[model samples]
Target: MISSLKRFLIGRPLKSTELGEQRLNKKKALAILSSDALSSVAYGPEQILIVLATVGAAAFWYSLPIALGVLILLIALILSYRQIIFAYPHGGGAYMVSKNNLGITPGLISGGSLLVDYILTVAVSVSAGTDAITSAFPALHAHNVMIAVFFVLFITLLNLRGLTESATILAYPVYLFVVALFILIGVGGYTILTGQVSPELHTPMGTTVTGLSLFLLLRAFASGSSALTGVEAISNAIPNFKEPAPNNAAKTLIAMGSLLGILFSGIILLAYFYGIAPSEEVTVVSQIAEGVFGRNYVYYFIQGTTALILILAANTGYSAFPLLAVNLAKDKFIPRMFTIRGDRLGYSNGIIILGFLSILLIIAFKGRTEQLIPLYAVGVFIPFTLSQTGMMVKWFRERPKGWLPKLLINSTGALISFSVTLIFFLTKFNQVWPVLIFIPIMITLFKKIRKHYDEIAEQLRISTCEEATPIQGNIIIIPIAGITRVVENSLNYAKSLSPQQIIAVHISFDKEEQKKLEEKWGQWQTGVRLVSLHSLHRSIIQPLTKFIDSIERRTTGSNYQVTVLIPEFIPKKGWHHILHNQSSFLIRTVLLHRKNVVVATVPYHLKK
Candidate 1:
């Protein structure tokens, strides 16, 4: 069943060389890698305002300080992770970092945290995009769940087709959005500077300027930190880069960081300058555009393009999450299936799981951005904290002479990143603490499962003692349906074992077949005893097991062993064994349960 499902979902597997054919160039790779980071510009500022709404519009200015804090954290994280790409460019990201430095538990934590973050990256990006689309088209505002689900399905299908396919499709719109955004920001800034702003700039939503407090500032900082959610994608995706992975990865990081920083900062500043209100009814970008180019075709075109980019940005998570899970699975922090690559060499199972979970989140939140934001930064921060801590350990362990400048830089990066992580934790905990607790619990469970697998693997290891155990008092029993070459082969193999006694057991599911089998066995001159067992229940394993137990009771003595020879029958095509025959497997499992009994199969090929 599982095999069929896998074949249906991913099709036949491809070889590594075929997989290599799907390798993405740096340009395509960057487009895929930067999707999540670029998507942030669409809604990162809106998230800040959503949080600041409680404190009023005056608190919206807090986005500046918040954006600054996030920027500092982003720069530090990028620099610290550049060293990671240099050190371990094979691309395990947080999992490799934590495993190499902080041990398995920390590795699981980082892995689980990153997994959750990836799922949320998809959910949040899609939800935010859907919300923006709804804002533009009020009809969609009422059907948010349907809209979000459709987008999730679209993204899932695109990714399943392959990363390069999805990247090629998304590249132009994202690039167009970036250019349109720059143009809007440039035009808006010029309009504001020349004091040619629209009348709506002075229309306030009853927001009064109030003195800022530490709590409010921290809240703003936490909200604005959404921009940093996608910064780690480059690290997670380093392996997908072309030859010279570290150089490509470092270059990708720098490009993503610089572009994201400029776009994010520009959007926030433009919104603030144009007196854009933070309201659930209106997005800041739309408001700023309206203020700058009120109801103009160019403004609507840019808005539409921005909405498309936001939707496409979720593609970044679609590209990265599966690869991240594959990395974790390789390190034994996730299930083995996650490590299995598709025809495209992407972690297809992980991608499907991510898509399913993101869809669930989108459904649960009813595609509301406001509802999902609370859970957004929690998972990302956990990995940020652990990754920074791991880097600190990496720095200390590899202490190099005359590398003071590098050491100091890493140390400062660690300090700033760690500090921001703490602030994010404290500020977002009330809303996101549940996810923090949930992630650790999952990591603990994963470790326990890994330990169990290791123990089972140890027990299954082959030893010479097992192969050298001498056969003593061998009694052979052959299970038969009727007279055929399949049965004859089993009888011959039983004789070859040179058993002290040989018995052929026939299960009577049908009286006529049993009578014919009995008559045939009576005529056979193979010198084998015949025993018939009645199975009123019409089950094979239970009746065969009872006969074996009866034989064992008759010969209870030291060094006595029972060898059961089972005839193999092909029901139809050869692969039909999987589709139709399960009784043979069940009998083998039941027989193996006894210490003295060993089951063997004699195969009879069916003519094609």
Candidate 2:
């Protein structure tokens, strides 16, 4: 059943020869790494408005402060993660950062938080994308779940085909989204600025003006910070960059930060100028698009294209999650399966697991981006908090000569990040704190389970001397067939056990081969005794059992323990079972039911 499920999930495994070498250049690497952050422009504004909806139109202005706050936090985090990439250009991101600076426990916390965040990233991005697309084509709104499932499967297949294939395909859509959005915002802003009569778009039908309070502002800020989700993905993916990994990663980080800042800021400004009101029902971005382009063909085209970009934003998690899992496995925080590369030299297991979990989340939340938004930021913030704290520790521990400047910078970044993390937790507690609490609990349990497994493994290990411990007995039974290499090797290995006496025992069914075997045994040395039992009825287990009983009865006065050394062969070809068979298995099963008998296998390697 497990094998069938595995086959179902990953499909057929490709051969190593079929995969070829991974040849991602710097440009391609940056594209693949930046896709998630770039895609955020689609939903970031929408999320900000969703937060402000609870407090009505007056609180909509608060989005500016909240967005600016998020921007400040983004800058600090980008700078801090830049230092991280410099320190760990080989990848591992939060896991490596916390593990190196704070210890394994903190590293595991970072790993768990990053894992949850990545999965959420995929689900939230894809769902929000689907919502955007549905907004343009109201007819398909009912089948949002189906569309989400299809995209998830499609992306999963693309990733499985290998990174380069997926990156090439995804790069164009990401570029189109960026260009279309910038064009719309630029044209819309110009039209509004030049005193051209633009459509006075009203708020969505159901929205009303409700008064705001302190708590509402905090929630709005927390929600707006979701735009900051994919900012750290590049830091985790630095190892995948071309040679001079640090420089390439730093450049990618700067580009991502600059692009995200402009795109995010432009969307917010455009939404505000166009009078895109807060809606508990409809996205402010969609409303802004409708107002700018109306319900005409061009507007629908922009909406559809924007939705596609948002959906592909989930691809960021696809690129980041596996790398995080690989790093966690390296730190022994996660299972070693995550570290095993597939034929394409990507972490296939981790990727598939991420895909499956993201699907579950998409289904659980019923594809509602607003509902999942709160849960989304919690995990991201936890890692952000720990990573910043870890960076502060790193800055102090390895203080360079001109250290005060660097320390102040890192400390300030750490302070901002950690403070936002605290606010997000406090404000989002009712909605998101459960996940924050749950993730750490899981991390602790996983660590305990791993420690327990390690202890059991240590206890079960066999030492060399145990293999050579002498068996005290008057009679030593060495089960043999003909004088084949398997039988000879078993005899030699059994001798290493240093039994008090040695006897070569055989059960013969055919008279002709029995006579030939007896003649061969006649040439053996004096120290060894030969014993043969007649099994004319052709039953191997019965004869062996009777002979062991006879030997035990005769040696009642001495310490008698029968040691059976069985020669076993393992096949080279997985499908060669019909050609060769093993008899030691049957013998071992029968001997296990007997008293004062022990069985050991002496493995024989077969020629290819």
Candidate 3:
């Protein structure tokens, strides 16, 4: 029933040979990979406005300059990542770039930061999408947490269904959002230019509370930098593209960057001219839509698409996180389980884990986008800086054709990225310190995990110089509940091993039952020793394990080996197994860890 349900939801499992067919073309790839970056325009400009709004309505005018700073950084990242796509076409993104050019430490730091950013992408994007919904219908504001969590679950299920399938399902909303925003910006710009509506310099909302300073401007820039969060995803996911992967991926990155720049700048300009103010209940995009269309159908259309694209933005994290995890796993810095693909050829484990973590963040922050935005950009930009520096080092070391020019671009990007990271750390330290500490903790964990894998390989290594230990004889012990066909079969199987000695033992809680078992064994004329252990506390496993431990202690380091053969009767139906006591399973689970003991299960299937 479970398998049938799974097949129904995710569809039938595709063959491994079908993996090639699953790779996406540029159009579809843009929607899947660029959604996170594209969706940020819904709230990215508002983040800057939000930070600047603390001083007064007049400070909201600073949002334009701050957005242009973010846009400059975005251009640098796009250029740097395009180089990354060409250089490391196999696609580990920032993790691979930093690890290969720098050292393992930097690599892990980049990887850890990307991991954190991906998780935040899901949380922040969904929370923002929920905010858009509540903005549309004020009555739904109370249930935002539930709405955000449901979106997470829905997106996670779509990803698990398969990559190409998810791209197909999620691509439409992205294009629709882009078109809708273009219309909003076009209409809003026309009104201002044609004098249909006069531009307001002051928002006429909040009073003057504080003064504007350099630190405040830097803080606003740091907040707006969240717009660039998903830009690295394209570089990380080059492998997901069709043949000629690098060129196609680079083109997609350019297209995505172009769209992002246009939309982000357009929104910021409109917000400035229209005198938009950040609202707690309604999003900045919703306000812009209303200003242009005045709560008409087009207004709701923009709101709906904005919410949709934001919700779908989580797909960027969904696509990139697993790919990065796979690279880490291949390097032995993480568990190998992440390297395994699901039935749909997606990294199901990593996808599910991302979903779970994002849901937790949503619940913890009460699905508030403003609360979660502080922790967003730092994780992404740390990798941005590291990746750019890594590439710069590569250019200096390799000195390929035109390496000097490439180095200059990357060096500038690295400088800008480093500055943004520092500003985010200093300005949002209270909210973001946990992530600063988390990256180091993650790096330490990566080292420990790598060390453990190395130790395991060394221990499991077989050397030609080592001598093999020979077994002198085998002493087989049959654990029994009563005189039954299953016990008889287990004894027969044990006898086939040509053991030096055989003993049948039973845990007898009642004296009368013990005597009856002995009498029955005597009547059967079996030459095996029948020792009955009496448990005062009525604990069967304790006495049974004690008996095995005593035997192991008596023959420590000897050539002889002890084998405990557990007899279990298999139930015909899956659910019927729960009806019986699982003593054999419990006994086997405890004894399997003994050094000198070999545990075996002898199953007798029930015809019923």
Candidate 4:
């Protein structure tokens, strides 16, 4: 029944040959991989306002310059990652690039950073999506965390259904969001040109809390860099694209970057013209929609689509985290189960783990986007710097054609990424300090897991020069509680082994039971030795293991093997097994570590 339910939800298992058909085309690929980067425009401009809003209305205009700076850095990163795509089309993303060019430590650093970043991406995206929902209908504000968690679970199930299928389900909403934003931009632009609406009057946002300085502007830029977090996912998942994956992935990246730039810039400009300020309950995009279309259908249409796209944006993290985990698992950094594909050909373990982690963050922050944003950008930038640095080092070593231009592009990206990392540390040290501690701890854990796997392999390796030892004899020992049909089956199975001798050992907690069994055995005349021992403390495993130990110690010089046959009764129903004492299970569990001891189970299935 459980299997049937699972099959119904995730569909029947796909054949390995069907994997090629699961790869996505360019249009669908954009919706699958680029959703996080594109949907970020919903809250990117507002993050800048959050930081600049600290210094009063005068500092608000500075958001435009800071936004342009983030855009320039965005272009540099796109060019840098495109070089990565052409060079390593197999698609390990930053972790693969860093491990190859740099050493294992740097690679693990990149891998760990990315894993944490992907979890945060889901948390931030869904929380922001919840904000859009509540902004339109204020009554839902109290249930934001519950709403965010529902979307995470929903997206996780969709992803587990397979890549192409989820892409088809999600692609329409992304295009709807893009089309909706362009309409907002076009209509808003028209209103300004025709003087239907005048520039919004600016109000001072209370007294200046902090004096405006160069540091403050950089802080705002750092917050705005959240827009660039998911940009490298395209390069990381090159294998997920259709045939001619490199060309298709590169084109998708460019297309995604173009859309992201246009939408992001348009939102920022409109917010500025309309004098939109970041509100706790209402978002900047929500405010802009209200200003342009009022409370009409178009306004609600924009709100609904914005919420849908933002929630689905977590698909980017769902796609990339599992793919990255597969690479790490192959290298023995993480557990091997992450590499296993589910019934629908998705990495089910990684997807489920990502969902749980994102839900934890949503609940912890109470679905507040502002609180989560501080933890968001730093994880991605760490990988961004390392990946670009890895590429820069690769160019100098390989010196491929056009190495100089490639080197310049990656070098600039690396520098800008490193600068962003530094700014995040300097400015938001109070909030982001936990992430600084998390990366190194994760790297250490990766090394420890690798070391454990290496030690296990060495212990299991066979010796090629050693000769095999031959056994001279065998002894079969059966532990019996009473003379029942299960005991008879065990005795017959032991006889079939044709050992030198068979001994039935019983540890009796009561004297009357011990006598009754001996009398029955004598009357049956089984012609096997019956050894009875008294357990003062009624301990079963302790006395039985000791008797086996005495026999092995006595036959130390002889090449004799000892085998224990355990008799078990199989229940008719699944829950019926709980009614029995399970003595066979206890003996088997204790005897597994004994040297040169073989254990076998003789089962008698009950009809009723």
All candidates: TM-score:
0.83, 0.75, 0.96, 0.94
Top candidate, metric TM-score = 3
Question: Which digits, one per residue and each the tens of the lDDT, describe model 3 over residues 1-608?
Answer: 88999999888999999999889999999999999999999988998988888887788877766887988998988998999999999999999999999999999999998898899999999988888988999999999999999999999999999999999989999999999999999999998889877645545434343588889889999989988889999999988999999999999999999999999999999888888889888888998899889999999999999999999999999999999999999999999999999999999999999999999999998997566676778888888999999999999999999999899999989999999989998898988888867888999999999999999999999999999888888788888889999999988887778746788989988999999999999999777888899999999889988988888787787988888889999998889988999998889888888777899999999999
Q: Which should have the higher lDDT, number 1 or number 2?
A: 1
How would you encode candidate 4's per-residue C-alpha lDDT over 1-608 as one tens digit per residue?
78898888888899988999899999999997989998889988988998888877666767777889989999999999998999999999899999999999999989998898899989989988888999999999899999999999999989989999999999999999999999999998788679777645443333344588888888899999988889999988998999899999999999999999999988988887777888888889889999999989999999999998898889999989999999999999999999999888888999999999999988888887567676778888988999999999999999988899999999999999999999999998898898868888999999999999999999888899877788876788899998889999988878876546789999999999999989999998888899888899999988898899998998788878888889899998878989988789989988988877999899999999
- For 383-417, candidate 1 gives per-residue lDDT tens digits of 77777678778767887564455566556666765
**Where is model 4 poorest over a 10-residue stretch in terms of lDDT?**
199-208
Q: After superposition, how far is residue 559 of candidate 4 from its true place, in Å?
A: 2.9
Candidates, ranked, TM-score: 3, 4, 1, 2
Model 1 has an lDDT value of 0.76
Q: Give Cα-based local distance difference scores for all models.
A: 0.76, 0.75, 0.91, 0.89
lDDT of 3: 0.91
Ranking by lDDT: 3, 4, 1, 2
Q: Clashes in each model (backbone N, CA, C under 3 Å)?
A: 0, 0, 0, 0
Cα lDDT, model 4, residue 235: 86
Error of 2 at 585 (Å): 13
